[model samples]
Target: MALLALSKCYYLGNLDQKVFLNEIKEIIHFHQEHHNLTRLAYQSAWELLIYTLIGEKFYEQVIVIELHFVRETRRELEELSKCVDWKRKKVEREKETKEVIVLMRWLNSLEFFFRFCSFWNEEFVGLFGNVVQLFRASSGNHREIRGECIDFFREAAGNKIMKVEGLLKGGAIDAVLEEISQQSLNEDNKICCFSFFLELSERLQEEKEDEKEEAKRKVFDKMEEEGLDDCIIMFHHFLLEEELPFSYPDENLECYFMPL
Candidate 1:
């Protein structure tokens, strides 16, 4: 299922190299022990695609550093697993994860990391590309959170949900949205995703009159330090004069803030 989702990640979004390598390592190691090389290879390829997408998010220099780490660790972990014939060690490490996923805690570490990345750009976006989604999923115990965000909101907002007879055409998403959107999901995810949407919408609005006034103060202060306040005028201030833009309709998109 992860593999299937990952296969679509490339055209869908990108990830940072460090994040990609770490995530790919978890994915590869999980199924590496499988008896069928074919299945494992398929999963690996999908993970590689995801990694490459993530790699593209970074500059070449940063990616090179992370690639070295990924290669080194991949080799080291492979060697470590081989040197130990003890099934107990493998079981111990895997069991410690608490979840069925490989090195789940390590993956859990990525939550804060992706939130940090989001401050940069939404370009590296995908099903689980945003770490906050992972947090809402495990911490809140919402198994369908991914489905809610991806299957329902993101994809619907993206216009990706097609005419499926029961599942999508007339599905649980329809039901859930009716309830949740009416009064919000009342879950952590509801607060998080909805808050994100609200913030994004507000950001789309260029600085308000008060914000412009506050911004003028800061700019003028900086200009006093640099002696360039009069020399600097707000260029490309169209946002201040125009209405906030909205994401356009598509066959595969959902309106995350439609509740408004």
Candidate 2:
């Protein structure tokens, strides 16, 4: 309840700015010490913290705070997949559902934060890797969060502002592309995977011919080896049928979309 109230203060700018920031840092520190990752209450409070920080326009501060516990936080998120008993009654699953929702909201806030903040350095590479882990863990449950994970990949991979070198170092491309090859994912995730391929294909178009060919070769070779060469055609059809989610679809992908 205090965290929620603090969020309002932070958003409304009702408190002294430095004091509020320090209090936020202290509050998160307290939560980290007191809240076990398995508890829905912990997840809820953590989500509110992220919400408050982003609402207060403290994106860099949030990044710094999260980076401090990135590995632990990621492990907690991945553990969510294991802790839930899906066969339990709906009433029993309520807590798990709420935890997933809170985590998803936290991830959504991170995605929004990254949009306005440039991540060009090695310090920010963990965020990219966390997204990949979250993507893998969000599978089989929490479809909405899984979709949001793919949305992050699409944005990060497609956006020119995002540095390719950093993403590569973080293994975002290989991880996501490997996920695209997996057959067990749900339909929403499949669509998202296809969308990621389309966005990546279009992004590569901006590179010089030789660089683009080398990159495409690497991506296509991986896809082909995985027996998902058809995904290339499927993504192209999505563009042609106007099913892709991009606001502005690239028209030059037909050449690349040709059978490999």
Candidate 3:
């Protein structure tokens, strides 16, 4: 809790920048060395790191690169993912379940960062592949984790700072369409999937007119190759089965309904 409080204080400009940076460095080291910490404590430390990164001034500090923040966080998540045993019952594997929950928290934090923070560069590209891997690994169960992954993709797509090429290289299109095809998705996640696709389409449209057509063709071809037709059928069935209250604008709706 103290770590979270410190993050909040730093975000609100109540803490001196140098002091907070030094404290954050110490916390990062502590978190890395203290593998025995409770899951809740570890999660709080991650939240602190994420919150601090959201601050533009803090993000610009050399400490972000010096400490290898992206690499460390990615490695931590990858390690935790290996600990999850989906075949076992949640009660029997409580620790693994907690790890899954922590993964979800990490996803949510990254999504929030992508959405609100304008800072984007090559340093953050590796995390995109991490998100894709988590999405694929959590398939058939852990709907919450998958939903968080979709939300992350949605925000990353909409964030103008992120290039569409980065998303493509990360296999985001395949992940988004694959998630949309899952029957277990709840209404909210279904909406998020559509939003992700819409955002991707909008991002593609931002290219020069000549490049725009080629980009759209490539995405459409990829979508078709990925069984987009079946996804559309499933989505149509979903619309009939559930009375979703939220309405999509015509332009946004066209992305789905337009002839392939």
Candidate 4:
């Protein structure tokens, strides 16, 4: 299986590449093994985290790379969402379905990476939306990944090349911000969430400045109608005093993440 081969590389790759690949690697990072799977795969829980991100240019390349990831990661997240009563097979099926959600998060990162590359794939945008549907408050990883996706899109709100039109058009931002407020006040990720909302607020300022008055007015009016003031207040309540990490737009994006 492509999974077995990739697992070898994933577990044994040079430190540089291992660190590089870890960012977009899904939590369902590999297929199941018989032994102590989690420990064997990740001795340090923090090691499982995504830190440094790698961006690419072309949609086709993103697709190919992500498909490879799927081939390798296909085994762990299979469960059925359709079953009312927990049938044995249904449990098995939704576990698989969970992988689909994980894959969408991976794709979301790829789409962001491609903001540096020339290739654009509309399917990835659509894929991101599909993954959000599977986000349930019951699942921990799902909740985490969904938050990360929200942060990613919030940053992407002003992206010139590929704004997630569906999200912006459909009001997903408000829905997710509301969800974030309802979540447990887990302190670990609070800083990250605060940073993301700040980024969104910054983008809103930019929209007010760059776009026409009518568009800006409409945006503000929409925010008012949808309880965005309360959401913004919620964001401020969560904000910490620490400095947020600032990442500037890549000016020389034509080459860096572009497919070779």
Candidate 5:
């Protein structure tokens, strides 16, 4: 209907289109009018607006519009996550499961949108916990959704604007370290976790000319203190399995593994 037309227009419009604001406002109004959009059809309509905004090229305008609904959208996503049975034992009605699937897909799109926009606000930090919970649950069976959730964390953790102390206090770093310590963790998952740490380390220490090694050393020390020696050993095994050279190209890696 009208929403569909609006979405098409916005998607086709250029970055500087003047009508974007009006369309954004109208979509927000529609969302507010139907607050509880549990029905799959209605949620699909709601997601059209999200998808449109995500695909838009004008980041400035998109940021403003996204922030407008970020809180409510996150709340709705949290509720949907709660409804999912992570163990896959509590089978939901087929229609309801389909609805949840669509909603989660919309959440995946939102995560992508947040990537280009700054999501370091207090609200986003709060939402991060729910996202992590969903990530843990999605790990059970929903592979694609789990990857999307991980990407959300990856983007947030790598965002230079994100407060390092706040992220640390939120237990994000600790959770990652713990995840890496798990023996059952796959190589790809380990790589993702390590990549986040590398990006985080780079951003956090980017300004200091000589403290990069010190920062990396602190991470290694924490990992060891947390009894992650096995994890490091596994990482070495991963490198060997990949047929990479025993020595890294970077000189700083000389002392990375130590005498363990």
Candidate 6:
């Protein structure tokens, strides 16, 4: 509750910039050292971190090195990832499921923060490699984690903050496309995967005309190698076979649809 209230105050501009940065640094430190925060606490901490970064004050402080938010956050994420044994059996990992989900959420939030803030420095760019590693470590049976991983990829690819080539080279394309190819994914996740491909294509279009064709060829070559075309065909077939809530009228020309 205190974290939520603090986030509210920060959002309202009631908190001093120095104080808020200090608070954020402390929170990041705590998270780095502690891996047993409750789910609600993690949610509140995530909200607080979002509020901290959404404002310009944090960015200004970061630029002048008043705060080590980026470096600290990277360390926190590294420590958090260490707490989860992704290779363990499902039964063994059941106790850590909540932490795993929290980790994914943090990754999504950090990716968004970096993208929105345009933090494209070497320090920030290095984090994308970590995102790919976590995504690769994720179990195929953990749909929620994989879904969030897909979201991180979509956000990373949709924006100009991170180069598409870097992401592709970091194995993001392979990890995401492999997950999308899983036969057990539901329709919603399949749609999310499709959006990632679309965003990737859009990002590629942003390249210079001279280099655009080659970049597209390389990305599409990787996609084809991962069987993305087959996945799209399968998703299309699934959509076609899905039943609609309302049916069309026959040739009798009578209106059969009714509004709720």
Highest-TM-score candidate: 3
Q: Give candidate 4's error at residue 131 in angstroms.
A: 2.8
Backbone collision count in every prediction? 12, 0, 0, 13, 0, 0
Which 10-residue span in candidate 2 carries the lowest summed lDDT?
A: 36-45
- Rank by lDDT (best first): 3, 6, 5, 2, 4, 1
Across 1-260, the per-residue lDDT of candidate 2 in tens digits comes to 55444444435644454555565556556767775334444444444455445434355456455535455456555666465443455454535565566566556655654554443336557777777776665555545665687777766766655666677777777777777677676656666666667766656555444574587668767878899968877755654676323344556645434432
Residue runs of model 3 more than 4 Å from their true location after superposition: 4-19, 29-43, 52-64, 89-96, 209-260
lDDT (tens digit, per residue) of candidate 5 on 53-85: 553446434543553555666666777777776
How much is 133 displaced in model 6, in angstroms? Answer: 1.9
lDDT tens per residue, model 6, 88-182: 76666536555676676676666556546654555555566677666766664455565676777777776665677777776778877887778
Error of model 6, residue 59, in angstroms: 1.0
* lDDT values for all models: 0.37, 0.58, 0.70, 0.42, 0.59, 0.62
lDDT at 17, model 5 = 41
Of 3 and 6, the candidate ranking higher by TM-score: 3
lDDT of 1 by residue, 1-260 (tens): 55545544545444444555566555555544553333324433434433454323453223224333234323333332233323234334533321223223223222222332212321222222232333233333333323233233322222211112222332323433433453435455565455444433334343354466687677667767997744455532633566644444543324544444
lDDT (Cα, 0-100) at 115 in candidate 4: 39
Error of 4 at 253 (Å): 26
Q: Output the TM-score of candidate 2.
A: 0.55
In model 5, the worst 10-residue window by lDDT is 251-260
Model 3 lDDT vs. the true structure? 0.70
The C-alpha stretches of model 1 lying farther than 4 A from their native spots are 1-107, 118-123, 126-184, 206-260
RMSD of each: 15.9, 13.1, 13.3, 16.5, 13.1, 14.3
